[model samples]
Target: MRELSFHGVTVRFGAGRSALAAVDGVDLTVPAGSVVGLVGESGSGKSTLAKAAVGLVPTTDGEIRLDGAPLRARRDRRRLQMVFQDPYASLDPRMTIGASIAEAVPGRPGRTGRAAEVARLLELVDLDPSRAGSLPSGLSGGQRQRVALARALAAEPDVVLADEITSALDVSVQGSVLNLVRDLRRQLGLTMLFISHNLAVVRYVSDVIAVMYLGRIVEAGPAAEVLTSPRHPYTRTLLDAAPRFGVALDDPVPADSELLDDEPPSPHDPPPGCRFHRRCPIGPLTVPERTVCVEKDPQPAAADRPHRAACHFASDAAPASLEVPAR
Candidate 1:
């Protein structure tokens, strides 16, 4: 497994005054042989950061390293492969699953004996090798995603980027796929970056979780610690909005706790100070806190060992229970 590192990574779209920083000066690392989950809402730059790692998108600033070597200069591009969200779009419509998987086997392009390798990959993903001849269109959504994962592994990638690969599948299918990924990581010691908006899914599959807001990471820590006792307010807000395991069904939802109505400020010219200040539920309540929030951007600082948050009022204490009794 290769350690993937992003140092001050920044990706921009368009140019000049209209330029938008899709991924702002972000520093992240996916430790060798561990899965790191990047969780956030849409447009939070999760996908862009993943794409940037494999050189699919250019980084306007910073650098990406694979096991301490520059990602681009490395001769073997197959060491880092991505499994995208859309299985159908990622696969070749006309190609058989076997052929697709075999084609990705590094240094063996169009060579004989690929059938054996293809069958092994199929088994690795828990798919029947007999179905390898089936076209992508003939397979179920879950099966197609497995095929995509198998194809990515055929290259023997040291780091795999699984970007919302199960989002489009049924809940049952999603569980199966996630289980397969978790099992594979344990068995093969595969390093991965798992991106998704579902906090539950992220918690299940990741050892570490990073919460992104706008183009910055607001919180990052051990999956259990961050998910269960989120330090950042944005992390707490997300947990409240999602269907948590401990949240009671009869709990009264706070009327004032809904997300901000306005869309996030444009990344082209992000809001000054805390990018989340406009939507921060706690910031506006106090004068001094509001002043710090509106006047200065909070840098990610250590909250605990291996845990960090970029909030002025971050806490180590577990947040209050979201299960409020109905009035």
Candidate 2:
């Protein structure tokens, strides 16, 4: 496994003043043989960041490095593979499962060798090797996802970018796919960036967690620490919104609590200073005296810090002052 690092990476669409910053100047690292879960809302740039790493999207500035070396060429990029969310769309309906896996294998392994390799990959993913001849249309949703994972592994990639790989599956199937992810990481020592909107799923498969809001990673740290004691207001809100087993959907929300229902500011013309201030529960919108969040952007914590939050009030008593009502 290889370490993947992004340094001040910025991805912008359009040109000049009309450009939309899908991924702002962000710095993150996926340590070798470890899983770093990237969690956020739908338009928070989690998917965009994954696409940028695999060269599916263009980055305006900064660098992407694998094992500390810059990825400037196409072949170098092949080592960083991605497993997209939709398994049905990712695979070809006409191709057999074995044929799909074989397409990603490097070099000319010849006919017999290729078949053996394909069968091995099928078995690796807990699918019957005999079903290699079956088309994607014949498999279940979870099985197709396993095939997608098998195809990514066929490339022998150093780092895998899994972009919401479980969102489309049924609740029961979601657990199987998630278990496969954990098993793959342990058995293959895979280094991965797992992106998801579900904090519960992320907490299950992640070693570290990074929470993104409107393209910037607002908080990141060890999974246990980030989930149990989140430093950022956005992170706390996400944890609160996550569905608990006993909690009913119709449970009344506190009148004093500010929900995340407010739409985020447009990325095309992001507001000055902290972008989250408009929707921040404890920001200037709630506390009239805290104008700093509206006037100046809060710098992220130093890279060396174990647990970091990009909020000026993270270390202060702000979180204590405005308690988010418990579910």
Instruction: Provide TM-scores for the models.
Output: 0.91, 0.93
lDDT of 1 at 230: 80
Query: Which parts of model 1 are misplaced by more than 4 Å?
Result: 74-76, 109-112, 249-256, 285-289, 300-306, 315-318, 321-327
Candidate 2's TM-score reads 0.93
Q: After superposition on all CA atoms, what RMSD does each candidate show versus the true structure?
A: 3.0, 2.5
What's the number of clashes in each of the models? 0, 0
Per-residue lDDT tens digits for candidate 2, residues 85-135, read 999999999999899999999899999999999999999999999999999
Top candidate (lDDT): 2
Candidate 1 per-residue lDDT, tens place, 85-128, comes to: 99999999999999999888877544457888898899999999
Q: What overall lDDT, based on C-alpha atoms, would model 2 receive against the true structure?
A: 0.87
